[model samples]
Target: MAPPQASSIPGRLLKALQSINSSAPRLIASPTAVGSNANPGASRRASVAIIIRLRPEDSPPGGNAASPTSSAAASASTSPFAQALPLPGSPTVAAAAAATSEVSASDKAAYPPAQKDVKQQLERFFEQDWVKRPGTTAEILFIKRATRATDKWSGHVAYPGGRHEPDDEDSRYTAMRETWEEVGLDLAEDDYLSVGALDDREITTSLGKRLLMILSPHVFLYTSPETPVPELQESEVASAHWIPIDLLTAPAARYDSVSVDISTRLAPKNAFARAALKLLVGGMQFKCILLPNEPIATGALPSPQAVVPNAPLKLWGLTLGMTLDLLSSMSLPTDAAASKGSTKSGDLSTYPHAVAALPQDKGALFAPSMASIFPRFSYPDINALIWIFGFRYRRTLKQSPTDSARVNWAGMSIGSYYAAVRRALVVAVVLRALTALGGLGWLGWTLRKRLQSRRTARALAL
Candidate 1:
């Protein structure tokens, strides 16, 4: 066969075989890099290298494959990488899928997420029991009418608050200021349990100016077996009550109502409280009560210019709304059976009775006396009365040009003082009116004088 002509074919094969055998047995062709000599199969595997690289585009794609000899250069020109990756059943694909699933499962279990906004944060805060609890103890305060021993609005539903002072720092201070001044309760620093603040309003006061009343209404509960006893201060408040928060918020219990001047209505706690009351009939959920509706400047009455007729007492306005809001916001379970089983009030008792059941450490539960916290009024009469001074000191005072001066100079403080002054002023005005009618005729003047004297006597007495 003349050397079989196979030598030509075998010559090239022999050279490749020599290269694989002589070298460290590279599994790759050309054998430019390190290879394994430890394994004899490495040489045997060298022949298969050509088969693995049969696709010229088997190399990675990129500028890094700029070299013409680089396998990636040829691979970059074609879609070889996609072809190399085995589908579904490949070990490499299976391992990667397993890893991804494991990671996803871990992440799903480890991290969730939440909501953060001012309104949302506040709403969340109000849902707490301490925030929601009907404050069993509360006080009401008002300034005494001029020359009167009693307050301008006696026996009225009111907030235990006063104007904000420099020390009060905020509206909470106003509430605390009035609380301290009106009642002798000494609430502690940590005693404050704030819910949410009500809207702000300009209050046209009977005492004076259009004061900016920034009311920070709060709900604080005091639980005890015994009723909460409030130390009364005759100067600031004649009385204090610890009524149920439920009652105050109850639509049925709301007794006072006028034409919807400048008030908002709070929805009734249930369908029952809402259907019964009429004056609280605005359909909204809040109402406004003016503290002393006299002129701001004159601090006197009978001036249309002084009355901001529709100006809501923003401070108390919001407070009232919040009080009702807090109560109605609670959602009792609709299923009677479910609610009965879950209900906790059955075993619960008042503060003293529940001492064993309640939390042990209730940091501070009382506020300071109003006299201790509130600044003394600047005027001599107001200041003297605030300090509980006797009439002797007031009797020594001099007269001024106005009738107010005469009343202030009189030995009177409290509700009786105002009554006396009001009677005297009304009598004088009526006497002038009678003179215009017929100059105080015997019958008219005698009857008027008797009535006037009786009213004056009543006003002067304590």
Candidate 2:
């Protein structure tokens, strides 16, 4: 009789599934032969443990949220006790937790209440700066860690800004609203030179709170040439300070090596050190080492290779990453300009004696460089190169698709490597099964034991 036909949908499905399963590596043994392995009991136990770990624990009998674990585990999960717990996707949290569980274990310890009050207090403080002059420096308030509310990210410093309120008509309105709410500054449009929308980022507060702060930092220029007074807002903004541009530009003002050095002559050494240290630390630390002052003319702003206005200052974590991204962006050409110029090199080997046969000034063949495009651009090529090296590197400089073909080849290689590894694993399992079934070692051991006993008996008889 002919084999049964798989005409029905179920039968067809079964056949298809069998074919697919045959080609795939086996993950489970058939139930009928499950116990027919060298270590069936051990394997079964491992499988059961894996399944249990994957299942969500049943809720507690009470009205309260279901408890994942009971007894000591519940108490140990408290913020203070849980500080050392690993947070998902956190590179530092794991190492930090292991190094010092005491500081990170509990929710309260990891993010205390003090951190919460600072954001609220600082927000209120910046609201009072609205009527103030432009061109003056301002310190954006940040939350401290010890008094933070949640474990998500506690005790981190950040700008005081929130979602647009009903009264805010536009981004400018929202900026002012946040400024009023967070810091006591009441800023006006004229006070702000430019308002730019930066890349949106999600941030977690120290109190375990998550928020999407669309950073639209208003470049407020002090209109008042006179000394400006900062009004501190309650709960939101705790305090404010006027930071000088020179302080940021000076080599003596950074925790790391400065890009440029300021001319210091005829300044008092002790006074210069104190000022420089203050500029470097800026509430980051209690004290820092700094260079001594030469004179009033000695401490000048060091001219950097490139200086972009409103360049982001990276502090920590996501904020730091975002800040770096912004700084990097200052160097990248827009999509339009990136498309300019031919990437091809002319055949120079045919005319080795002629310099003209070499790769033409391809830059001129398309659009001029950003520096030449904007003659007013003050930065030199060296400074621009340093500032935007990352952007330049990331750029797809090739005009033709063939330049990126190597990436495709690399991807194929990776896939081949993965397939090879899978096949090797399957072969290893099959070899192990064959070795176990043959029992060659066990048979050899029995024969050797019998021979040794017989030899001992013969020796005694002799």
Quantify all predictions' global Cα lDDT against the true fold. Answer: 0.27, 0.27
Model 1 over residues 1-462: C-alpha lDDT tens digits? 111111121222222222222211001111122354332212111100000000012212111211112122223233222222221110011221132232223112211121123223233333334323333122222222222324433333345555433333233333443454444333322222222222122222322122222232333322212222333344343333333222232121222222221111223255554443222222211122233222111112323543455342221332333332232223222322332453232111111111122121222111110111011222233333322432332233222211222322111221232333234334544544566577447779899999999999999994
* Candidate 2 Cα errors over 4 Å, as ranges: 1-146, 150-154, 202-215, 246-250, 253-314, 321-462
Each model's RMSD to truth, in Å? 40.4, 29.4
Worst 10 residues of 2 by lDDT: 46-55
Q: How close is candidate 2 to the true structure, as a TM-score?
A: 0.28
- The top-ranked prediction according to TM-score is 2
Clashes within 3 Å, all models in order:
32, 80
TM-score list, all predictions? 0.27, 0.28
Q: What digit string (tens of lDDT, one per residue) describes model 2 on residues 16-66?
A: 223221221111111121344433212111100000000011311111321
